[model samples]
Target: MRAAGLEPLEPYPGSGSPWCCRHEACGREVTPRLGNISSARQGGCRYCAGKAPIPPDEAQALMRAADLEPLEPYATSMTPWRCRCTTCGSEVSPTLMKVRTGGGCRFCASHGFDLTAPARVYVMQHHQHNAVKIGIGGTAGRNERVNHHRRSGWVLARDWHFATGVEAHAVEQAVLRHLHEAGHGPYLNRDVMPNGWTETFGADLVTPATLAAIGTALLSSLPVTLYCSGSSAGR
Candidate 1:
């Protein structure tokens, strides 16, 4: 009938692409595999190597659920996504199409791109309030600095040098001020900033320690950031 739930795959319905014997009509009837639809008439199936008859309507429904409509011509090919790319006019490979969320191909990522600007979020770890370390991910277009780091031997290098004047120090102050105004002080959410989210933001605000606790936190948790402006912030 309609194939035992999941027996025969789509496109190649009705004809199981059988192979057959060709011993000069010795009364043999082996179902040989189906031939290339383009050349089926001359090449035939598995048993007798005959033609792969067109699939009946029952099998068509199965193909439909697989998002493979417009059957009948399926005998020519089995791939579900047999279409041309709208952009480059190239044949979109079926393998690539299968991985996407919807029924579109890889070209879908660029076809209807939204070119508008995206809002940016800056992150840095804030400690007792003296200094901070920054980390950044990708370049936010031409305006933002590219975050990068290089290591030599045991020492690690954190450099956020931008062709544009995106010095991290100034940006750190701005972020600190913004955090201060937001009353988001003494932040315990150091987990959210990630390893090097502030690199693109530029540099940290370093201030002399006013108390032993501040120095201990700064040295021990070298990970946490200083929240105040550098210089005489000891007050």
Candidate 2:
């Protein structure tokens, strides 16, 4: 125990039993089994191992610095901490470790299609499978979602950029609902298009043009607060 930076607080307990010791570095009382410590299976002190109990005030300050207001008292670092996003005013629960590692509010993340950020709704066609797909994604420069499909043998038939992902997603869902009501549900299995098979449909049942038209009609019907722009078709 001395070699491991711990001083025994009492008489020796059996090797398999819990032994009380004080960590010399952090002065924290920890109960660890001698057998486990001797076998190098467990650390001598949780505090020195970075598992110490964090003061509530310190945890709250860390969350506030990340633009999150805690909705409840702080819990374990690994447990979800309920909070409200100062940026988007959305309720979110994120772990302390995740926050410490630089994760922030999901609703305001640029890569996840922030609701108030620009996004795109797309219609894709798979020539080999005679299928079509409808989806929404961020309108960032890369357009990774669409490019991912292109690499998977799906051609972009049409895509429209909207002021926000909320609008784009609304249009995508409206079009998908129309397809589902018209008896054009998912046609591909997970094996073929593992990433987006749930959004795919048989081209014979509904053409890519039809899907694009539905999306366009829905986009036009949305409130004036939402607006969109056209983009060139294909890859």
Candidate 3:
């Protein structure tokens, strides 16, 4: 019995009586007839006595299907495991059931990132395209913004700027309309560009000079608007 897998829990001093042993898989103790090799080797633990535990391979497959990479030793489906979210690349220790139920990253879901703390306007340019990308950065912040673009194969061309998300949006719209009226019409490139910024890609469409002008105009507009709004509220 010792040579076999069963752990002997009692002194068997060669006594021709029933032997007490415990199964390693499940801690259930049982008495087998002395020298009964077959019965002694067939001790089943508590977990094995009921339903079989899920195999590691099957559990890993389930996690991969839900875009989560398992980072813990998988024992059962109910075990709390640490997994990385494929979407935002954030780690979260969610139970197997929670992941199986199509749960996503709470950080992204709740917009709990730095970008969302205060609305941000950002200017980014891609090397493949001539136009600078002016858009609202997601709540993830500037670093995440760069990561997102790089993942999409867009190389950052120039330095980026940040302002209030709302004011940045206004600047974007104003620049777009101004460029369009000057015969740079239909700047929105919905098809090719992944980020969907007002795409003005041409030799003379948008240059460093253009960006400087827009920035200056936006800087002047913000203070005036704030003053006007304050006057109205006071009145």
Candidate 4:
């Protein structure tokens, strides 16, 4: 068996049968039902072969369907690429397979926020526009959350911290609903932002008084754990 390129390892036990053959080429522990190791054909790693390099065109098409335009020349599907994401109009580098699998802007997703952890609700302001966005960032820390938005050309105006994810989500909804009812539709300068779909409101409309009122309403409606007094001063 060793002369035939089969590396014999410990005997593999099966129902009423045992095999004494193993292949190191593919790193498989046991060769299923080997009569004689000599007749067993040597096959290369099946796992690597299954992950064959994907064609550039197919990868491009997959990216296009996900509203992402490749920034670099297309390589293999595994290559990392800088791409323009239409979902948030941000330049992001993600693997071809990730985009193909319906992955979207990382900033918008809060860098895969962990729902099981405490959530931080923030009030972010647009650098060049008179707008503010109220949002939630889960276990993905506040600094990371702000950095993601900043990389996408947004500036963090304020961060409203909450003790739990539930509190933040509830308050965020309250703020959005209040803004939407006020006819701003929870978006300020919506047409100006590139693919802007974040929950935002006009700077003039999102005054300190308005935020206080909305926060108070949320505090009353939600559990006692929901606190709004710890909000950072607006920038």
Model 4: ten consecutive residues of lowest lDDT: 41-50
Give per-model CA RMSD. 22.5, 10.0, 19.8, 18.6
Per-residue lDDT tens digits for candidate 3, residues 1-235, read 6554568887884535677788665465766555556555433342343334656887787777777788877866545577887878977655565555555454445542332234344445555555555444433335575467667655443332343444444555566556666776534364666445434445356754565466456556553122111101111
Which regions in candidate 2 have their CA more than 4 angstroms from the true location?
A: 1-111, 224-228, 231-235
Rank by lDDT (best first): 2, 4, 3, 1
RMSD score of candidate 4 (Å) = 18.6
By TM-score, the better pick of 2 and 3 is: 2
What is the number of residue pairs that collide in model 2?
A: 0
Candidate 3 wrong stretches, greater than 4 Å: 1-116, 138-143, 153-163, 186-188, 224-235
Model 3 deviation from the true structure expressed as Cα RMSD, one decimal place: 19.8
Best-fitting candidate, measured by lDDT?
2
Residue-wise C-alpha lDDT for candidate 4, range 1-235, written one tens digit per residue? 4554457566555523445555566555444344433344423223223354556787787787877888888876645577898787977666775665567555556546554467677766775666677677754435566566667666654555567765676677677667767677645443555433447666686754466567666767766365444445442
Clashing pairs in 3: 26-45, 116-139, 119-165
Which portions of model 4 show Cα errors greater than 4 Å?
A: 1-111, 139-142, 151-157, 186-196, 227-229, 233-235
Q: Write the per-residue lDDT of candidate 2 for residues 38-75, one digit (tens) a residue.
A: 99998998755656787789889889999999999898
C-alpha lDDT of all candidate models, in order = 0.32, 0.80, 0.54, 0.61
Over the full model, what C-alpha lDDT does candidate 1 score relative to the true structure? 0.32
Compared with the true structure, what per-residue lDDT tens digits does model 1 show for residues 1-235? Answer: 1111112223453444543333333343334334433344543222233223323353344334444443133332223434455544544333212322234433344432121222112232233332333332222454232222222111112222222222333333344444445444432233543333322221132322212223333333333333323221221
Best by the TM-score measure:
2
Least accurate 10 contiguous residues by lDDT in model 1: 147-156
